[model samples]
Target chain A: MSFITGKNLSCIRGMKYVYGKVDFTVDAGEILVVVGKNGCGKTSLLKTIAGFLKPSSGQITISCADDLQSLDIIHYIGTSSSLKKQLTVRENLTFWSKMLDSDADNIDKAIKSFGLDEMSNSQISYLSSGQIKRCSLARLLLAERKIWILDEPETALDNDSLNRFIDIVTNHVKNNGIAIIASHRPDIWPDNKKLLEIG
Target chain B: MGAFLAILMRDLRSDLRNRAQFVMIPVFYILAVILFPLGIGPETGTLSLIAPGILVVSSLFASLLALEKLFSSDISDGSFESIILCPVPISVIMAGKITAHWILTGLPLALITPFLAIMLGLSFEIALFSSLIILLITIILSLIGAMIASLVINTGKGSVLLALLSFPLFIPVLIFAAGAIDLAIIGGIGNSIAPILFLCSLTSIALPVVPIICAAIIKWQVR
Candidate 1:
């Protein structure tokens, strides 16, 4: 089993401290929902664990059976869709598949699971914001990374898409994936998740 | 290798789909070159004398047109964050991007140079040789531009800032490339070989180093 542990995690942005003395642990098949008010450094905390930002103090470590480094196992998805508007949905996913050296079969699986099969050939520019978000999330399945560092992944998603997303994350956890989600609506996630509140 | 090629093809395909932006650089290059001859009175001797400088300077500006968005689009759209987090080395990704930029902006500038040179009254042999030198210089420009583009990705007026930061880096290459072509036109191919070799050496050095610098800068920007 794999797990992530953050001990007294404090982050600083510029001269100001973002969040201080935050501690949390998330094992395989569990979700860590980070919640707080606006400007609570929720994004900064997630980015810190995702390796995008340096922690001013404390340490965050990932322990897994595999020999892969912490970066190799983490899949960090920020607020932006990160898809090319000029390319079709399939084209974007295919590019990620090759870039990550993932199994080609996962592309079709991801498209189907994310309900993107119907618009698979449509350019990203033509898709709705919710649809674009789905395309970006489909990337998580394109590779078998163990940790999912998601920041407000439900922002533009509609109700049906949101339900679908929760299902996907549930399924991912069921399959032994770790999801560290930063969301304002933590109720959407199932119970049995650790809540870390920061501001 | 797979990641590099994937990024390259993805960029190429994206540029192909947006043909307007793809065509703008070469069109800009041609227009810039055409203006020089018109303003200089079309005197063959004057045109020939200034052709090397004209081609190099225009190509430099034309190449700059695309460098502004080289990494900014990716950064703004979030593709860069995703790409950087991938298992492949960031240098590989940067190489792919630089190659794509060169193909879209630099390669066209180099390819069309010979015709522009001949139009400015240089011999076919000299034009052919000058195009090769221009090609090498364009490669180096793309490398330098990619590095600077990544550095200024988060700054306001990035295009202007990019040009400012990259111009000094580009000047040395510009001097050598134009000097080689001028030498070729004035004293024949043999006299231009030294500067040509110098351009080649510059490209070889920049090819491996620029990408690493770009990767590091990009990482820093996101941080």
Candidate 2:
């Protein structure tokens, strides 16, 4: 069975329409890249799949042993990064750690893995743009969700950080996790990555 | 219970982190009360006559100042989104946030009213009793104000909209709070306590119900 599936998804914001009789599925160990131009509802599609936005006329089926009510198993990293500027890096990680209910072992590993230890005390507002992006991406790294929906995760990072981010995405997919990345940058993904174009 | 406690702790921590903004509310409350005597001349009878109204209005305004930030910051930072996605009810989260807001703003203003009363020439009993009444009324009014602020979270100029939405709702609370003190000063403490008790009752009913309504409105707005 597919880990995540959306059938006949349709969405409309204001008067602008965004819909098609689209059928899509993501399995356990594959990366799907969604490429489109500026106004192609890429973020909307990711939001719909992540259960943040309700499609006007469609059904989303997320397969898991848990009941439907407990199936919010997707972690979303939208364009805004959504990190509070007032909070220090460690405080921000601690907040998400508590939210995810991850044990200390996993949280420590995530902090180390993200190379966030040295800058942990710095407020997010003080971080460089690349650091801010890394701080936001750290949630995707730490969360145990089976599905990851990342929107424009490569926007403000240097080449080194972008390569490191690709490594993290590849590692997540290697662990039987599904990823849906929406970006205009095609060179970020590996050659074997599945491409889905939406206009 | 865990979710409620988490929200309360988070909000309290956030409020404490912004010490200057939080501290200024009570400071302003006290300063506003002190200024009243300067404006109207410090005649003992006149100061005594207006002290209760001054205390209640100042407390109301101080509480309102912090109300706008109650949910907007959380909503803008995506904290509200995470909370909404939690298994817990949004109403519970809203209640926790509103309760924390009251503890920070309303409670401080109420606690400082006794000091303001002494400066304004109120008797000891009148000062203490008036503080108690203001505390009760401020708790309720803060919750109602939070509800109004949450409803207008997405609206343009939310603070003004919150005031426009809440001032009418605040009339009854202001009336009972000031009236109870007035009655006490005139030697009708027995008559005053009943209105204060009624105000408390209104708050008790509003405390649980208004947040739920406001949460519903917020859900609709986000959708």
Best by lDDT: 1
Candidate 2 lDDT over B1-223, as tens digits, reads: 6667766777787678788978989988888888888899989888998888999888888888877887787667666555454456778778878888888888887788787898889988788888888889878887788778878888768989988889999998888888889988887678687787889799879978987987786666555
TM-score of every candidate relative to the true structure: 0.96, 0.91
Query: Across residues A1-199, which tens digit of lDDT does each residue of candidate 1 receive?
Result: 2388889989878798789999888899999999999888999998888878778999877775333222678888998888899999999999989978899999999999899999999999999988999999999999998889999999888999899999989988999989999999999998988899997
| TM-score for chain B considered on its own, for each of the candidates | 0.98, 0.96
Q: Candidate 1's residue-wise lDDT over B27-51, tens digit each?
A: 9999999999889898999999989
Whole-structure CA lDDT of model 1: 0.89
DockQ of each: 0.76, 0.36
DockQ for candidate 1: 0.76
Off by over 4 Å in 2: A19-21, A65-70
Docking outcome class, model 1: medium
